[model samples]
Structure formats: C-alpha cells, structure tokens
Target: MIRIVIVDDEVFVRAGFSALLSLADDIEVVGQAGDGAEALSVVRQTVPDVVLMDVNMAPRNGLEATLQIVKLPEAPRVLIMTSASPDNTAWQAFATGAHGFMHKAATPAQIIGAIRMVAVGGTATTPEVMKRLIDENNLRNPRHVAQARSRIDLLSGRHRDIILLVGRGYPNARIARELSMSENTVKSYVSRALEKLGVDNRTQAALLVRDSGLLDETLANESRVL
Candidate 1:
C-alpha cells in the first residue's frame, strides 16, 4: 500500500483530501495535520511514503516545512499543492526536494496518480510547471535559446556586454570595475536591461544572457571590429 499523510492549514481541505484518498484501495491515509509543525510531528510518527502538503499554511508554511522534513532519516516524498499556478514557488518547491507540484484544483485522478508516482520515488509535475522549472534553471531548450537571443539582440551593444558579465556571475561592483564605470551606473544599466528584457530580476536576465549564446556572438563581432 502507498501510505500517505495529508497536511493543510484548513481542516476541511485535509478532510477532503483524506476522503479522496480513501477511494483508492491501494492507498492509505496514515495521518493528517493542520500546519507545518503538526505535519512534521505526524510525519515522524507515521513515516508515510508520501506527503500531500499544502503550500500556504501559516506560522510554518509548506516550503519551510519541506526543507526541514527532507533531512530526516528516510524522509517521505513531499508533493506540494498550491492554490494557484506554480510560478517561482514551483522552483522553490523543487529546491526543497519536493517530489511533486500540482495546483489544488487537480482532479481526484490526477491527485491520486501524483501521490502514487511520488510514493515510488518519481517526480510528479504538470507540463506547465515543468516548463517553468526548465526556464527558471536556465536549461537551454533550442526554442528558448532562440527567443532569448532575439530579446538580447534588441539590447544596445553596451547593454549586451554588461548582461554578458552578469551571466558570468559578476556583481554590480565587479561589473563597474571591469567596465570602468561607477557602481551606481552599473546598477542603472542592469535595471534598464532588465526592463527592456521584460524580466523581474537579475537572475532571470542572467539566465537569458546565458541561453541566448550572446557572449560568443558579441566577442566575435568585437574581435572583427578591432
């Protein structure tokens, strides 16, 4: 049997999930909790094969708990369930070594299948969430690289050079020193680059720069110009 625990801040949600699991003869709801701390205690006691974790619990949210839970001896695979689209939170869940991510709106079949998959040490994720993770981690899908290259091409040469440094993991101060510009100027350039690229943070911009293969192209062009 695939032993399971359901963890959610809402009593109704925990109860409802447990009820849903009861319908699957091969799965067993071993315990339930209303918060992260309670979830931890129950997990220690039950040592379920899989944990159905709600992502937004209070005092100790699911992500925080998952981080701790994975350290224990023979930790259960945690499957995070969020109320909305995964976005950056999906990346965080994977960082916590979560085995799966799915919106709370997942159908009963999907939820059951996810739990079963996780129980057997498999990742359970939807296509959208998986794609987000691939992009977030800067995995170079060919199409993604093409898109990133086009966006980076729209940047001025100076901006392209700076973002290349950013992709090489340069800090603002280091970039300033390397380019013989003030730190404040580097910061402004970074902010503007991010704006033009339509990304929220330096990390995403760095990912774009790396994916775009822009560094080699820029260097070759500059060499030719020289």
Candidate 2:
C-alpha cells in the first residue's frame, strides 16, 4: 500500500483528503498535520510514501516545509496543493523539490492519482504552470546548451529524436508520419520516454524536454537535436 500524510491548515481540508484517500485500497492515510511544523513531525514518525501539502499555511510556508521534508533520510514525496491563480506561487514550489503540484479545485480522483504517481517516483505539473516555467526559462537563459546536454544524456539517439518531436507539440499520428513509424510505435516511444523521465504524463514529459533546453537546440539546428 502507498502510505500517505495529508497536511493543510484547514480542518475540513485535511479531513476531506484523509477520508478520500482512506477509501482507496492501494492507499493509506498514515497521518495528518495542520501546519508545517506538525507536518515535519508526522512525516518523520510515519515516513509515509507520499505527502499531500497545502501551499498556504501559517508559520513555515509549504515551500520551506517541502525543502525540509525532502531532505529527510527516507523522505515522502510531496505534492503541493494550491488555489488557481497567478499568485499561487507554483514555480517556487517546484524548484524547492515538490514532486507534483495540483489545483485545490481538482477532483478527488485527480488528487489521488497525483499522490499515487508521486509515490511511484513520478513528477507532475499542470499544463499552464509548465508553460509558464518554460517561458520563464527561455527568457532568463536564451542559451540552453547545458540543459540540452543533460536531456540528451537521458535517452538513446532515436528516443531523443522522438522526444524532441513530441515537445514540438506534434500529435502521435503526425509524429508517426514524420518519423515513418506506426502510430502504435509512436505511442510506445512516448510512453517509454515518460517512464524514463519519471513523469506521470506526456504533457509533463514534453515540458521537461522543453525546459531542459533540448527543444531550443532542435530549433537552432533545424533538426531533431535531442
């Protein structure tokens, strides 16, 4: 079973998540905390497989708490929950070692799925937050050579080519046509790439490729660069 901890300042929010997670056969709510300090204490004691953390809270904020938690010897993976707004502060959360981020308005199933994915060592990012991160990176560092090198090392030459095409927003059918492979083969490659990258979904994988500077290299070279 995937052991979990729910952390939120509001009593109802914590109870709701705990209740929902308790119903999942594969998941167990090991503990709950209403603040960052309590969250740290609970996680250290329980060593749960995953943590559902609220970003806004009194005392130590979620980002700082996440950094502390991730440094634990056998740390639980953290999924930051935030409201939907430009002021939500997701990028900082991600940079601080959050394995995933989800809007508070997400359905219970989505919340559960995000926790499960993170427990299995996968990263998750919403599409809008991902685009913002990519755009920010592009603006701050126009030359992404170092980032490109890291992404290339993550895959075989053929797989890297496939990832670049996917990052360019190509549909699987179009990717298959361009690469002279069947659609099923294209899907297989994308799935494998997602697994290798430790991301929960294709959109996150594509965003990773883009943020790693591989996409920039491909554009500059006028070919599938990495």
Per-prediction tally of clashes: 0, 0
- CA lDDT, candidate 1, residue 52: 92
TM-score, candidate 1, is 0.61
Indicate which candidate wins on lDDT: 1
List the lowest-lDDT window of 10 residues for candidate 2. Answer: 140-149
lDDT of each: 0.81, 0.77
lDDT of 2 by residue, 1-226 (tens): 9998889999998888888887789999889998898899999999998888988888977888998998798878899998757343776776577778888888888888787767755566567766776677676454564564575468886677787786665657778889899988988988888677766555455656766776776788876454
* Model 1 pairs whose backbones collide: none
> Which residue runs of candidate 1 sit more than 4 Å off their true CA positions?
137-226
Cα lDDT, model 1, residue 6: 92
Clashing residue pairs, backbone N/CA/C < 3 A, model 2:
none
Write one digit per residue (lDDT tens) for candidate 1, span 52-101: 99999888999999988877887888899999778788867866767688
lDDT of 2: 0.77
Candidate 2 off by > 4 Å = 84-88, 143-211, 215-226
Candidate topping TM-score: 2
